[model samples]
Target chain A: MPEFTLWDIVRNLLLAARWTVALSFIAFLGGTVFGLLLLLMRLSGRRVLERLVGIYVQLFQGTPLLMQLFLLYFGLAVMGVNTSAWLAACVALTLYASAYLTEIWRGAVAAIPRGQWEASASLALSFGQQFRHIILPQALRIAVAPTVGFLVQVVKGTALASVIGFVELTKAGGMIANVTYEPMLTYACVAAMYFVLCFPISLYARALERKLA
Target chain B: MPLQLDFMSILVQWPLLLRGAAWTIALTAIATLLGGMLGIVCAWARAGGPRALRWLVGGYVEIIRNTPFIVQLFFIFFGLPELGIRLSPMTASILAMTVNLGAYATEILRAGIEATPRGQIEAAESLALTKAQVFTRVVLPPALKKVWPALVSQIVIVMLGSAVCGQISTEELSYATNLIQSRNFRAFETYIVGTLSYLGLAILVRNLLYWAGPRFLFGR
Candidate 1:
């Protein structure tokens, strides 16, 4: 049996934590872009587009993310498209995050009084112009805190990627525990690392909410 | 070859799937009851207990909130044996879920509790109601009512999260799907069924909570 000092386990977990961070960043960024598009579609006043986006959001939000990852990982491969765990994890997390982000931003946009839309329209502003100049500016302010708060969820969600063989902090801890027979110490470190990464964001989100309120 | 999906290969194992779904519901039900109680206690601690107890509950909530549920499951299942507290997969899954849900519930309930009007508590006290009666009669019902929706959403979230317990070999819905897939090599199809089942369960649980909340918990 390989003897792993506490430092060894901590170091390896920290190294793997980088992937957790990276995956979270990718998922959050991609989710934001896709979520923005869906938000626009929902707000476009086309009933078809609105309903379509609504189903998309509901489908993603309604399911467990682990199943989504499995479907992507195995589903893609079975379809003859070679899919790495990395690709599957990224895509799944991106879609999952997108669903929640769209909902969050939509709520923020919905909070805008109807008069703002009417006022902008009476100014002869196009929908795009109205969204860009008047609606988005106000909505973005409301959306910021929640969006940041969702990043913590993204970080935690990355832990699920480990099941599909992506070696993030959680997976790394499992491997170390297997080899070093230190599940207790190893997983404690894993939990600590996640807490360290997520707690600050959670606290900051609350602070932002207070400040904004 | 063109894409092919034979969900029948998985559906033929309906008994396994049914059992898995039952386990998932049972685990969630037990955890919800236990965790909801834990949340109420912790919320009281945070809202009105001693300062030291408040700090302790605060720490518990923060630690549980920040970590992933999977890691928490792993820790409880694998780590606790070191402390001479060995738990079976089912037990550990329940414990982790209960702990996880309790933390979030505490926060949600505390919000409701804090929002209780000052005059209401004062009025209850002047009526000579004991502290316990005041809390149960004057504060809790309205607080639960105010936060019922949020609590329902959290319960749904926790139910969806129990999917991770399958990784620990808990024989939940996802575990059954994994077994079916491994048996027939119908991974994708099996997962689709499992995922849809989860979505169905989430919707079902949410509606159930919403119905039960007003009917049995806080009055409409």
Candidate 2:
């Protein structure tokens, strides 16, 4: 019966933006840690480990995040493992981000010339030492730009967590619109918030890419 | 009691699942055709059109690229009606998908277009070719070929993204899965089936595009 102000919508959305930012950070950081491990496994020179990780990456990348979210949220509940939307979203998105990150880092690692490996080996550097000192340093430089660019994707991807009822920016917009009868304004605010979050990263990524090139 | 998995219960709704997948493909097909054309036009604008047009196209690419597709879809579906422009869910879904793909493809194709050798265009011009002839005969084909793999990947992404269109009740595969789950209370099984179907679809679509892009699009 009461009217909702523009400030009210923007204010509420700003509050919800924190969750979006938090979720993205959690997913990105968690994915990066796990993805680095996957990268190590892939580069371990063991054919079986490499193929296992390849299937893992494919399984995550080949399916929709929405399906992954649904599977986790509902699957967990069905298994009588009480889970909240937040927990489920975190798990699903972390896995999703890890898959892409692993592939990206692998490409960067692969870009390192094979000579780097042989040179390190000839110098009596152990496998871990070569990877730690020789390979990863060079690969990290190549990896930075694309990895930053991929953050935009992870941010955009967090929007899907709203499907499972995680009350991030997108879900908050829907809720506000439903309550205020102002779908246009609410969603515009939501989109604007996303833009504000994403555009600068996009620009920075491009700048880093050009700088790297 | 231990958890038990059931697949046959959801698999029985094969017809509904098929219909939903048909709609997803139909929506994607329409969007891909329209969106690919839109991308080319916008790419041309960004690459070679007038300065003002380039700015306009650039603005569009940045805006669409920065937002999530679901928000874009929601805006088109729910927000437009307030402006007295009502769209069916299917119409809005296709429109959203096309716009999303167009923005992404514009950037992708512009990269290809910009990489076109200046000498090639100059050579075509000296040979008395018109601007249109130069673009069509010498530029677009190779530009597309150079970026075909990226384009195909983007198309597959849009296809998988269409699953969200079901959020608006558009009767896509995810929508059918939701329906079957609600009916049978087999939520996990229904979504599992739906996910596998989407995985299969993504693989199939990617292969088809890769196989077809060279033969049909840019030519040998």
Candidate 3:
């Protein structure tokens, strides 16, 4: 057995946190792409497309993320796809993040005045051109703060992935606690590391929101 | 070779699954009640508390909201014994959930409280009611009634978040599923059963929250 000191625990946690950061970026970035697609699908003129996307958001939003991770982990392996805990965790989180992001961006886009869209259309702009030139830039401004706010959520959510056996910060904390037999100290350090990672983001989100307001 | 999935083996552990589900519900309910009360106090602090108190509440909410629930759970459960306070996994899980949920509840309730008009407080004052009376009888009800929707949503989030308590060996739904999987090697079916059970619990809590909304709150 290895002797664990405060520095030892923090050092190990920092290393594990790299995975948390990597996974958060993967989920957030990948989810943003899917979210954008879902947003367009939701805004499309076709009823069935819109309805399908609407239900997708509801299914992910209404269910627990932990459950989503389990379903993806087990579901993928059951379907005969090669499944590792990491891949399942990433895919499930991306899907979950996408569902929520789609709704958030959709709301942001809808809040843009209708007259602006009509103006862009009258300028003989194609739908893509109109959205690109006129709408998204403005909507992105309003979206920035909330998007960042949602990022804080994404970071918090990554902790849940530990349940799937990914050795991220929370899991590593657990591992260290088991070895050091200092559950409380090991875990408190874990919580502090998370605070260090997330608290600034929360404050920044609030500042952005205030500026936007 | 094709994957050999076994539902029968998983179903053979149905009693175990039910026990897990029962523990999850029990944890969720206990955490919510305690958390909800803590939230009300924090919320009240934010609304009318002293400047120092407001800063304390603000800091608490920001810290909790920013961090992950798993880390918070570990802090309270695995982290507390270092301070010489030992608690069972069940006790630790509920306490963690309550603390985590309270921060969120405070944020939600603070929003509700802030939205209450200053005019209403003045009206209560003109009636010469004591501050406690004004808060209980006049102000808090309307504030909470207006924000019940957001508050209920937070409660649901807390309910789902309780699943993390499995990490500490509380043998809640997820822990039980993990046990069954390792024991019987029925990974897919066992996990599927677990996910469905969680989804069911989430829905049931939402329904219960909705039903209790008008009865204990706003009906006076």
Candidate 4:
């Protein structure tokens, strides 16, 4: 057996980090689209549609993401669909992100003053025109900090994708530790990488929130 | 092959699921108590303590908050053993959970503490109350009351995170579900049961914390 060097471990982790970054982007982007649709349906003045979206959010938020991954992974298999960990992880994470992002965006929209909606209505603009031109821009300002902060959460959440056998950073660290018998170094590197990935966004969010306030 | 779902098969292993849920609750309870106390102390340190202590607490909060909880758990459970500080899975889970919650709760409590009016602290100081008395009697209760909802949500997040504790073989609900699935080849059903239990637990814990936050921690 060959000896494993520190650089080799770092290189392998860097390679795996690509998948982590990719998965995070997939989940975040997909979630934003879905979350926006849910936000619209929620604001559309249809009580049943609003309640349906509420249940969707509650279902996702009320359970562990781990279980969500498991359900998609095994649930897909049981339904006679061929499932890779990647597919299952992506689907599960997209739904999870949708749930959270919708709620966060909804809160931001709700923060807007009531007068603006009334003003838009009086201007004879359709609901879509009012929302598109007047509402989303303002809500987007409030939503930016929190949504970026939530991206950090989504990145961290992709670590759960590892449990289903997607070889992301955390899983790769575990694999490396198994081979090198150096879990301390491997996991320390893993934590540092995550910190590097998350801390700047966390800081930016804080700064933006402060500026906004 | 036709798909046949059997919920009854997984339901038969209720004992394991119950035990797993119990461990999860126990882990959360212990972590909540210890981590909540740590949060208070750290919040106090950061808010009113010396400069060095404040920086120290701030660093601790940032480091823990930025990293994922699962990695932290793995580090404590898997990494610590290499340093000659071996801990049982249960001990490591509790330690990891407490440290994780402590970091988050510190920030939450700090926000609350910072919101405390300057006048109130000054008034307490003018009363000749000791610093400790001023914090505990004058500062903490109202701060806690103000942030109880946020703190409760954090605790619930921590509780849901306990699902990962089973990765270390601590036999939490997810672990029990995994074991039953392996035994009976009812993976989907087992997970469904586990997920529902977690959902129930989350709701139950949130209600419990909301109810207890005022009655026990602060006056209603």
Candidate 5:
């Protein structure tokens, strides 16, 4: 059994923390891009397109991320596709984040009010021009607090990637704990890192909520 | 090159898949009952507890909310035993889920509690209802009802989260998906099955809650 020092465990977890950050950024950024496009499609008046996006959101939102990851990772492997855990984790999270983001932004856009849309229409603003000029700016403001709040969720959700064998902070902590046979000390350090990463975002979310209010 | 995949083969593993689904449902049911009660208590304490108690509750919520559930599970599963308190993986996972969901439920229910009109509490007091009686009959019922929708949605969230317990080999749906995929080489189909089953579960849980709401709420 490997006896662990406080500094040793902390150091390993801190090193793993970088991957957590990297994964969060990748998932958030990628999810946001996909989410924004989905938001647009959802609002498009074409009933088929809107319904398609609606089902997309519901499907991703409705399922557990863990099962989705398994489906992507083990399921792909069974198909002889031979995907890496990294790719699978990223794709699963990106899709997961996008569903929530799409819903969040759609609400923000809808919050812009019918009057504003009518005003933009009267001004001869094309859909692109209206959205690019009038609606998106306002929607972005409304979207900020919620978007930041959802980032906290995306960060927490990334921990689930450990199931697919991606060695991020939580996964690394598990490995360290198994080797040392000390769960609390390793997990305390794990929780601490997550706190250090997440508390600022939580506080910032509150601050934004206050500022917006 | 053309590749033909046979998902039909994996269907032979029906008994195993059904067992996996059973465990998942059991896990969901246990966690929901325990977490619901635990959450209601947490919600009450956070809303009305003393200053120190409030700090404790708030801290618990913040720590659990910030950290990953997997870490929490690992901590309880392995760590508690060293302190002479042992738990099986399923027990530990359910405990973790309850505590985690309890925190969020407290937040949700606290919002509902705060939303109660001040006049209503004063009215209850004036009517000579004991404080405990008032909380049970008047305060908690309506407060929970007001936030019932959000609370149930959070429950679904936790139900979905239960799949992560597969890492510890809980033989839940995710665990079953891994089993079928490895055995049949029908990775995509296995996932598709898992996804569809999970989605169905989510819907079923939500519908069950809604259908049973009036019965539970009004005791009809």
Candidate 6:
């Protein structure tokens, strides 16, 4: 067996950490766009749209994300649509992040006082206009801190993509552990990398919450 | 070719599914009990203990919260053996989950405890109650009532997270699903059943906690 040093494990894991970063970026971006769409649908004042979005949120939130990853990765293959772990992890994480983002953004929107809506509507603004001009701006401000906080969750969540064989940080750590026979050292390095990635965002989120409050 | 979904092939293994679900619930139950107690102690320490102890507990909370649960599980299961502490997969999973939940609960419960009005504590102190009595009787119940919803959500998250324990072959619900799928090659169907079962369990557990919190933990 090739001798592996601590530096070898850390360096390789750092390289693999890029994929974790990339996946989180994609999932957060996709989740934001998709979650916004779902949020609008829920706020659309149509009963069917509202209920549909509610069930969608409940369905995603109520299940294990591991199951979602499995369903997307394996389910797509069974459907004869060629599937890669990258595609499955991206899609699954996007959907998972969307469900959560929608809820967070929804709460932010709901926090807007009823008077804002009433005054906007009294101006004869259309529902779309009211949301676009009056509601969205205020809601976005309230949503920013929680949204940033959720990014930490997204980053940590990419660790799960390892199980689907996407070979990001955790997967690379597993590979290195096997080679070095240093499961303890390797996994410790893995956790440290995640902490380095996530802790700053978590602190920033806390700061934002304090500022907003 | 048209898609034909056959869930029966997976459902036919109901016994395995039931056992898997049972294990999942059992693991969650044990973790919740142990972790809740750990959380209370740590919260008390952080809220009212000495400066050094508070700093120590704060460090523990930050480390656990910032990392992913899978990595934590791997460390306990795979890493600890290097220190001459070999644990079975089940024991490792339970310990990991308890530790994970304890950290989050400390934060959640501390929020409630800190929100306690100074006047109430003073009143209890005037009655000549001990510190422990003050916390348990005059402070804790209301604090718990205040944060019950957030605590319920965290518990549900931890329950769903226990799915990761299967990665180390803990034979939880996901493991059972994996086993059945490997046997029948019904990966998609088995996962659907497994995912929905988790959804059912999440909802059930949430409701159960919401009910039990008032009736048992803090009173109606």
Q: For model 3, what is the alpha-carbon lDDT of residue A206?
A: 88
User: For residues A58-80, could you state the per-residue lDDT of candidate 5 as single tens digits?
Assistant: 89888988878877786556556
Tens-place lDDT per residue, model 3, B22-88, is 9988988888889989998999988998999999998888778878888887777767777888889
Q: Clash number for model 6?
A: 0
DockQ-based CAPRI category assigned to the predicted complex of candidate 4: high
Candidate 3 per-residue lDDT, tens place, A1-213, comes to 666678998899999999989999999999999999998888767899999998888777766788788888888977888999899989998998999899988888999999999999999998889888899999999888988888888888999889889989988989988888988777778878888888888789889999998
Tens-digit lDDT string for candidate 6 (B1-220): 8887888899899999999999999999999999999999999999999999999999999999999999999999999999999999999999999999999999999999999999999999999999999999989999999999999899999999999999999999999999999988888889999999999999999999998999999997
Predicted candidate 1 versus true structure: per-residue lDDT over A1-213, tens digit per residue = 566688998889999999999999999999999999999999999999999999898888888899999999998899788899999999999999999999999999999999999999999999999999999999999999999999999999999999999999999999999999889999999999999999999999999999998
| Residues forming the 10-long window of minimal summed lDDT in candidate 5 chain B | B211-220
Return the candidate ranking by DockQ, descending. Answer: 1, 6, 4, 2, 5, 3
Tens-place lDDT digits, model 1, residues B1-220: 8788898889899999999999999999999999999999999999999999999999999999999999999999999999999999999999999999999999999999999999999999999999999998999999999999999999989999999999989999999999999999988899999999998999999999898989998888
Report the poorest 10 consecutive residues by lDDT, candidate 6 chain A: A1-10
lDDT of 3 at A149: 87
Off by over 4 Å in 6: none
What does the lDDT read for residue B82 in candidate 2? 95
| Model 5, runs deviating above 4 Å | A1-3, A74-82, B218-220
TM-score of chain A of each: 0.98, 0.98, 0.97, 0.97, 0.96, 0.97
lDDT against the true structure, per candidate, is 0.95, 0.94, 0.86, 0.94, 0.85, 0.95
Q: Sort candidate 6 into its docking category.
A: high
- Which ranges in model 1 have alpha carbons more than 4 Å from their true place? none
lDDT of 6 by residue, A49-83 (tens): 99999999999999989899999999889889899
Better of 2 and 3 by TM-score: 2
Of 1 and 3, the candidate ahead on TM-score is 1
Which model, 4 or 5, shows the larger TM-score? 4
Give candidate 2's error at residue A34 in angstroms: 0.9
Clashing pairs in 2: none
- Which of 3 and 6 is the better model by DockQ? 6
Off-target runs (Cα >4 Å) in candidate 2 are none
